[model samples]
Target: MKKIIIGTLSAMILFSGCSNFLKEDPTDFVAPVNYYKTEKEVFSALAGVYDILGNRAAYGRYLFFEMDMSDQCYMALSSTGQDIALYNYDIGDQKLVDTWSILYQGINRANMLLERIDQSDISETLRDNYKGEALFLRAYYYFLLTSNWGSVPLRLQSTKTPGEVDMKPAKLKDIYAQIIVDMTSAADLVGDVTAYKNAGRVSKSTVWGILARVNLKMAGAPLRDKSRYAEAKKWAEKVINLGYHTLNPDYTQVFKNHAQKVYDTKESIWEVEFSYMSGSQYEEGNVGSINGIGTSNKLVGYSYGAQKIMKPYYDSFGVGDLRRDWNINDYYYENEPATGRIVYAGNAAAIFYNRSASKWRREYEITPQKSVNTTTINFPLLRYADVLLMFAEADNMSPEGRSSQAEWCVNQVRQRGFGNLLPGAVPTANVDLPTGLDVVDFQEAIQKERSFELGFEGLRRHDLIRWGIFLQTMQGLKSYKASAAADYQYGFRTAENIKPRDTLFAVPRSEMVVNKLMEQNSGW
Candidate 1:
């Protein structure tokens, strides 16, 4: 699924050098004066817009480990200095600044491409697809911004110079409205999943699935736009009715495909592709190394095993549910003799809280001589299972109430979780969610189901925040950890440090300095 365009596009950015810093454009070095002249150049520019998804500040690191350290997991080994996981970060925190800057860079790249792509003489079909992708990506970037920062500067046009950086913030609802508009238009313009045959590119299914997610966010806390629930269900049903995607039968194989740099489009609808080794060098991500099971031996993939699954999340899995062991490792790798052999703990209560998130184990990586700090595993952005769950959740939230269709959707996911994939295979009674749950009970079921299926995939934080349970969930962890053994008390630091303002991260000081019209979020 990893494309060759990444190398060419990055090289284009690097080689677009300037002799005089004062005279050259500062917003982006890949100047339009000499670029976007041909069809291939336009494609390369589109790849540049996609490249930011793998930047170190996004899915490459902070997204899965740093920003997403919610009630499900915590960093086992703290970094040398300040860390965002504990929620002690301020406006000047470099992690926040890098993430904010990287997202804007992506938006700017898409803006530049969209602004110039119409001049190209490419085939009408291809040009429209590229335009659609750029529009969707620009909106997706804003989704990340408003979802995290509340209100933000909605820059539709590319910035030309340093003087163009002082735009004021747009209200959160306005930004969401633009997201819906851009995504809705992109859905009509983009090709279908069969056309792309991979999750790396934007397709009709990708746009609709994500639109469901965006509307669900609006329907939940903060926005409280209940009408959007029906809209979310409408988009999610579109993806389902398209009949191009389904569960991959084996749940673990879904992630194993990512770990081994393979694409399974049936399960993974969209992904941020991270690659390794073009010719002599590598471009990788800190997926397995930082978040996988710990091992000092490079041969087994040197991992700090930074993240530990919270014991409560570990225990949330029901008996005979297969996802528990696959997601939360029940063992560690010994560093002795550099072979990094496993040391099984058998899901013992003593070590429950110490288990690593093993969804992206480096042992599955086929590349030779894995890097000490990075791997080629891709990060999934949207999956079919997620779409099914979203549809169910939205249907339950709609005035129609919980329907049999919603129950069936949740059952399909739960049955797969219990390893019942074949049509004739009987779903384990204990594993399947009970039928005819009331509105509130069914909603709670969807919440736990999402955590069980999508934990440690860089989504738990946003899920908690949108559901209005972020602070309560963190505080719940504090009480849960308080009852644990003394050694486990260290896990409660996140809850202790969290404040109501922690719901929205502070605007980066760098942006505040330049955009004088921007006001800080509540409580700095």
Candidate 2:
């Protein structure tokens, strides 16, 4: 069983710079100085840091909705107004306020934990581990902030009074520098994967994987720092060489494992844990409800049908790619047992609207009934397959473009997707990379591989943005959706409406109104 970290911080540290609308006065709150006297108290504090992952505003909702803005999926016509605004790139919309608030809340918890843990009388190893976990989490939150908003205010220390709060945005480069420093220190202090009792917690491999992603972002688009390309490759390679993780061979089993609350630590590096059994609505994860096919679709018994996969993206998969069959379900099983009796729901046009994000299928969920929207399925934050793809992309960007190592890394992912096809066997069904591609072509191939392999996983938008093709790709998608013949139609976005400033989200209007130092991104 996965060790579920559950704890509540005694005091909620409000962002004091913001007005009364944003601040919540503490009640019966034990201050950190008064609380961190015992080892259990310090561990409970660390659990408080992990608790942020279960917040609806953070990974549970906003993060998944942001994926709709990418080319991978579209918000269904029945989706919430806020989701529509987000998908349409309405920069001034207040939809992202929760995301901004919750992330800062997490950072505050981490800061408080780091501040108090040092004074505790815990064993040296225990202290180091807790410190490492806090540092990694802090860096992770900062990464999410910097990547989404570009220049968010840096708050390393816990805010004791309203006077100490700084609302000024820091440079992205400086934020990234801190991220690297924290993660590097985290990797050193944290125990190896084997040392960790559970897969849910951070390990040495987790730090390496995150560092690879961070370095890759620094090397791409806005930064264009070529030096980081080599660093990115180094980190990804380190994770691969560690031998603690490997591909899960069967792609379909991965999600099934998630639905059953089974942890395949080999492929899943780290996952955000959720449980409907927890009895608190905040603890439930709802990705399936938001994206699954609705009962109105005459297929699934229950679902919100809020988001559907875009036709263009679904069609982009190769002819025999197992991911297409696994990720996108054109049909639903008739009976409760789901005995492979596939009933074709509709033709291409009809299925487009009803197309289910089958990755998180409700049928696979081990709940008492199918009607329950809340699921215990953990959302994968990082996986070994992602690491392999990162390695390939980073290596291709390095001086050795189409190096043998790059080829091997890319092939490993491809091979796994192809059901671990034997060497020298003709992969006619699951197509492999064509031989003798140049650096440019190999890079393009890697991009396509990631798209096909990692679609609908909330990574597409960031990937496109870092590749410097987000705007152009969305522009093309708008035109493609506009011209496509589908049974159900909704207004598609236009290229002319998307400004370069739309790349970074607007600082929440509520936040901007209260803080004089807060600045909105340009054209917002």
Candidate 3:
């Protein structure tokens, strides 16, 4: 159901060192004047926009590894050089440059598709849906841009010529306002979740879930627009009240479905699709292979094992929390003694520095002759669990305080994490939130629970920043690591290098070079 195809459409926009400044000649792209005459062509253009989600600079690798790492996870100590993950990189770092470029490419693609879709002879319903998706995608690209760079050039129109590069940055609040408007409009136009057979396409449920996320960000730091908390609650309520999604009872199975390439449309509301080998090209990703349990042995499924779990995060889980061991690996694959077959080996030697992420295990991939660099495991964008937690946070922050309904939402996620929600399941102790927590206590609980439930899924850094404790949290980790045994010193690198300016990535140097109107973020 998650089919992504980049056809002979030569309208692909190439970047000049991660900047959007390019002079397009007649041969550079298919003239939009003649294209967009058919439904299939419009859909192909939309697919091109979605294609950026899995780009190496975006979700496919760096988003999780470079941007998302924090108190929850850190780059593997085996990594040789200091980079963005350690917060030591500058504006010219190619990772930031590539991430900036690819995100703009997506925006430009969405802009082009939206501009021409009305020219196509598609059905009214289909055209509306396409427009909704384009708007949402453009908002999403801006969301990532604003989330990282603070303020950026707000290019709504397609880049038709080289002169378009001189646009100035929009205010952060203005950018967020535009995001809400576009996503709200998108929510009205997209189809219901049930209308789609897969979680790959944008649906009403997906838009609602992400809108809640967007509002929640606004409600938090830098903006501190507490009014947006109500908006976040409203959007999350729509998704829940729709009765279209539920917590998949098995926490591990949720990710196992991802690794096995099985679509769980109810739980995973939206995902960035990737394929092992499509046509002559390998449209695969590093989801499991880069972040999964590390081993160089091809038989055990090759992974650089580059993502390491911090011990404090591992120990934060209470007893009997099933997600603890599943999210962080306690054992790793190695060549078996007798058969030489790849098998799990207890990680007795694992210190704070060596534990790898375990959510997307490559051993579960069904493809033959597994490639060392990539796997078909899809990266989830919006999951139902996230919506529930967002509802809880917004509800607690609202004037009404934490309602019984809000408490129930948080407990529902915990119940699943503790394996208490399975059919014919035995009641589990310590699976529910303690009775009678004040609003402050409840907010703290939600924060910790988010880390426990959603760790290493590329949300923790944003969560920390929104709570306005990103610096203190990293410093806390640094202190913890510094005081630990000498052997654990290797895990101290990221914490040691983090700085306040790191809250947002420096605007890419490539962009600064061409766009004279571009203003660098403070302290860059």
Candidate 4:
């Protein structure tokens, strides 16, 4: 839901060298050392933090869309259908590299602010707010990093040079410990969230929401330390008890017209704000305008003008799943502007048969020009429904896990997709299936519901990886293709590019060369 596919701005944005806060101050720049003087300065520093998360490397584009191609969201790109190679991997595979950079950038910014906050003379209330936010952002960034890389340097200080970060990957145990520390501390410092101006910015519920997710990730497959599930449940419950956010009464609001939900609705816990003026939502620009289109990963759902819905995934929906319609759309209108005319692209008969995404939902207001670049849709990163789902994921995985609570939680989410309304009121998931769902069945159901409820929201790849399902799913998806190029037909991959380990990622050669401390993941 946090991903906006405007068009192809291009591919992942990466930089070899990092930025410096105080290296050179613009004449209008607030000095890094002196910047935290007021609440606004603190807010200004956080502007790009979410942008970092949404980078094309993350959900901004490829990861969410492509991962969907694997499972719930959509079918893989035609190349992805054949290959699952570098193209599908632009985000998922290379994410480990770009994430290393983007997250460290946020962490450094947060650390610098935390290091200098006390001297700012901001009021204690504001001071705590800034510090709490910095801690939360740092923890969130680490969550993004550790989820993928596992063992990464926990750099607490802002290093201006490479020599300063001669740190090696910390144990995953230690990394989670750090996440807990920052999150718990952040929870204590952050009081009521009053910032309604931008729904994407961090607030108290946002902190707890993140804590719930962090703990859920820890409790699940890769780490498999079930003890943390109770902790995850605890954080989720905190967010729930606050009663700040609620499930969207309408499923489509979370995606199509997501901006309308941002500032006005009770559904969003957090969102990354994008605008035609003022702030920049970088991910939207990159994916919307960037590289995916002409390739198999094209924003066009299918060759047919049907708003891009993939075949198998679309078929996966059950009898009365409201989500199917909520998610799939057919593109019909053509825009004739002074810039030119946009003949609707995706619906090209049998050639490309896919439904367009409900979430790629962009600006109805922006007249499409040949160089179309206006989007009003905001990305929802967290929602009330996710909190409930995380609560279920945590409780079900806990040692004292109550089956009823977990069932209730899962049902709350599924009920909506099954066309039941009023949040958790659906009796379908609540009632036991004839054979009755056991732990394994429930766990599998949770994973699928997570995908359905949160498709295109940017969590797919991480969820797949954590479940240890990515490799299996990627390989399974690869087999469905007709081949890389079939007499210039669909489903063909160059044999050299496809492999199981490649499903993970190659350590960016740059980091391997520069930092001996970094070891690559199993496959490149």
Best-fitting candidate, measured by lDDT?
3
For model 1, how does the per-residue alpha-carbon lDDT over 1-524 read when each residue is reduced to its tens digit?
01112113344343111111111112244446567767767776777677777777887888788888899887777644356888877678898988898888788878888888888888889899999999999999899888888899888887666577677899889999999999999998898888864578889999999999999999987999999999999999999998878898889899889877677887898887766554312357787888888788777787887888788988899887889988988667666455555666454545876678889888788675577877777789999999999999999987866778888889889889988885577767766677667898999999999998998888889999999999999887876864556776677778788889988888988888877788899997
Cα deviation at 400, candidate 3, in Å, is 2.1
Clashes of 2: 0
Off by over 4 Å in 3: 1-29, 77-80, 278-281, 336-350, 482-488
> Each model's C-alpha lDDT?
0.80, 0.70, 0.81, 0.56
Per-residue alpha-carbon lDDT of candidate 3 for residues 1-80, written as tens digits (9 for 90 to 100): 01112332474533111111112221335667888778766766777677788788887788887788899777864456
| Clashes in predicted model 1 | 0
Q: What order do candidates take by lDDT, descending?
A: 3, 1, 2, 4
Off by over 4 Å in 4: 1-31, 38-40, 48-51, 54-59, 66-69, 73-97, 193-197, 261-265, 278-310, 330-353, 363-374, 422-436, 482-503
Model 4 steric clash total: 38
Which residue window of length 10 is worst by lDDT in model 2? Answer: 14-23
Worst lDDT window (10 residues) for model 3? 15-24
Alpha-carbon RMSD to native, per candidate: 5.4, 5.9, 5.1, 7.4
Per-prediction TM-score to the true structure, in the order listed: 0.92, 0.88, 0.92, 0.77
Off by over 4 Å in 1: 1-31, 79-81, 278-282, 336-343, 346-350, 422-427
Residue 192 alpha-carbon offset, candidate 3, angstroms: 1.2
